[model samples]
Target: MANYHRNNVENVVLGRHHHHSHRSKSASVAGHTFRLWNAASFRRIIFDAVSCGASSRYAARSNISDEKQHLQQKQQHHKTTSMKNNAKSEKLSDLLSIAEAETDVETKKKEEKLEDLKRLVKELQQHEEDSTKNKKSEAAAKVRLLAKEELEVRGTLAMLGAIPPLVAMLDETEQNDVNSLVSSLYALLNLGIGNDANKAAIVKVGSVEKMLKLIESPDGLDSSVSEAIVANFLGLSALDSNKPIIGSSASIYFLVRTLQSLDDESSPQAKQDALRALYNLSIFPGNVAFILETDLVVFLVNSIGDMEVTERTLATLSNIVSTREGRKAISAVPDSIPILVDVLNWTDSPECQEKASYILMVMAHKSYGDKQAMIEAGIASSLLELSLLGSTLAQKRASRILEILRVDKGKQVSGSYGLGAAVSAPICGSLSGKPDGGGGRECFEEDEEMMSEEKKAVKQLVQQSLQNNMRKIVKRANLPHDIVPSDHFKSLTLSSTSKSLPF
Candidate 1:
């Protein structure tokens, strides 16, 4: 019985030992899992904070720059589109799809519409060509007419392969049947107006050269037909790309010849169109040399007395004086200075006045003889007033010329007042005698007509002052009122009488 009791006690102790060790192992595993989870969560929070600070500024700058560039590109594209197209009358129901309220949607529609129109024009051209090739001139003509309408409606779309056949039609038409030729040329003209792309395409297909030949040729072409062609040519020169090509083709010389050749009584409008085209072509520096090569300057100089031609001529001469060669060419003309002075004298349009002033200003700036010629032609007083009275652009240009004129006169009046008396002289007639230097304008006298309203008013005031001062002189000298001859002396003085005595 003692041995059995000892064995049961030993078994109970071993069972208790095994239960405590298993519980301890489970507690250690739970503690290790909690530590690992805490570490991972802490690492994630710190990583997020660092990323927010470090990457956000650079990323934001990059994003903003990208967005700004995109907006600029979008705006430029929009402007180009607007310049080339007229907005179609979108249907009321279609407003939701095309309205600017939904910018992205509307923009996509415009792009798609432009693309569709281009494709349509291209197809029309192809059909026209195929029909014409098949000897189906009637169908070809109809297709061309439709293409012309579409091109007019969609301006730049004329560029998409439509100009080629239209130009070819001009050549293919019977020389004697100018009526049919007129239709084709008119179609091309409508297709080209304000459509810069069409101009590039036209130049590419040698239409300019063809038109040059057509105009130069004696087809006994109708005046209206010639006018349409010239007007269209004028429109095409509105494109910068066409200017260099047109200039190189001797368009300037021939165009001037055409003007001179046209009967003055017939096609007056055609003459104006030719002048305008010449003016537009003059905008290019390359064309300046070509224009100077012809007698166009002489034509322009002679036309200056006519108010209608003066404005256009002045605009052309303005561009011409921008270069050394042009200055020489203009000054080289015998009547150039007088013509410019005439424009300033009689023209009532402020725009024309501004152009004339600028041309004179450029000439005066270019050479000594040119400056002297301007003064001799009596332009200084007009320009001085123009500086104060003209448009903002005109004001700046005239002011600059006046400033130079003052300096030129200052040198001439070395002994008049102070060293720079001419600079301070308020009027062209401030000094009584002729300028020692010739580059300045003629000094005003007591009796000649005033060219400007301001000068006219001032002259009236001067006349009143001279009469009053003469009456005072007669009273002070105790002479008879009738013997004073105040009526004869009303507009004169010792200096003024001498000025008027020549009359």
Candidate 2:
């Protein structure tokens, strides 16, 4: 029993010692593990703190750099704006300076002109007061200067009493005063141009009568002096108020004489001026009686072929044809209608065509004989061609004439037959089989042959007209007459038909 109890106690003591030792070992191992884990966490925290510090430094540096760059941009922008402003300022200054300089120049020119005019007036007055040759020559020089000046300067001089002296100078009869006369005459002419008040003032001052006196003077004037007088007439006649005043005072005769003198050694310019003056005078219908008193209508009709003065001549005739007497005068000419129709083929001068057509239209509308004359002159084909390929105005006129002819045709047919014949008329030829004298068949055959012949004749007329017109057009274009192929011309002729003709 004692041994067993002793064994139990030993066993219990051994178990207690073993359990305590295990407990102590486990506690030591746990403490070492905790220390290792704490060390790892601390290292991680240190690394993260270093990373945050570096990020803050980088952010600060970036902000500073951005601020500096922004400052540079602001400075550059301000500099660029200042430069643009300065450039604009310089440009504006230059423009302003240039404008001021121009204004000053204009003012200076005006002052100079005023001074020159005053000097001219003084010189003219001196010449008027003193009849010495030197004074006259100086006065003549001033008049010549006045001729070259514009309307404004001439107006100023006239207001300063410069024209009466010039007029007085016109009465000089001495041969030595010829130059002074020419100077005064031309100065007066220049003063009248483009200034109606000056024109009226001049005519009021007896310029026309003075010129007529010079023209009719016993000692016949030289050609140059005559031209100067005609030029004066032209300048005066431009005014409608002066047309009658000048046209009634033997000016028309002088103008016609001047135009006639063109065939001689007279200046062509004088003829042109006379034509223009006559045209102006002719525009007044009452003046047509005076113009018809002269052979101007014949002269104008004959001169229509003159290419140099064709437009003016036609323009004058256009005015002449407006009056009843004028129309009779034109139609009285043997070939006036023919000549006007020929002008329709003048493709080279559309102006000539328009004026000629206008004259014809006026005549044809007023006089039935004129329409027949135009039709007999072969105006239909020419009108057709014109309508197809003419200027806008020419085309309109051509179409109008065609309409007139078309409308007049019915009137002509109706007039030839009695207007009161309402019943149907039988055919003139016998329809019965009974044979009578050969007159009926022969007349019917003759009528048919006449129609066929007329158709062929009209075709030939159109072809001939086309050829002549084409040749004229070629000549005017400065090309060879045969530049257009004959075959093409034939095709054109073939395409044209008298059946379609309104006339």
Best by TM-score: 2
Model 1 — TM-score against the truth?
Answer: 0.55
Best by lDDT: 2
lDDT of model 2 at position 47: 68
Candidate 2 lDDT, 200-314, residue by residue in tens: 8888878777777787878777778788888888888888898888877788998987887646656888888888889889888878889999998888898888799999999
Give Cα-based local distance difference scores for all models. 0.63, 0.75
**TM-score (all chains, Cα) for each model:** 0.55, 0.64
lDDT of 1 by residue, 1-503 (tens): 34444654565465456546555433335343111225785576567556665677778899999999999999999998885553443455478666666898778987886676566555435534445433323423444465466645535445455567667766665566566566667666766655677667777888877776776677566666677777777878888888888888867775686677745533777788888899888899888888877888777877775766777888888888898998888788888777776655332577877787788777776676666566555555555445444677666876676555535644431111111112223345434355553323444432233324333333443354455545655776898877555455653533341122111
In model 1, which range of ten residues has the least summed lDDT?
413-422
RMSD for all candidates, in order, please.
Answer: 21.8, 13.1
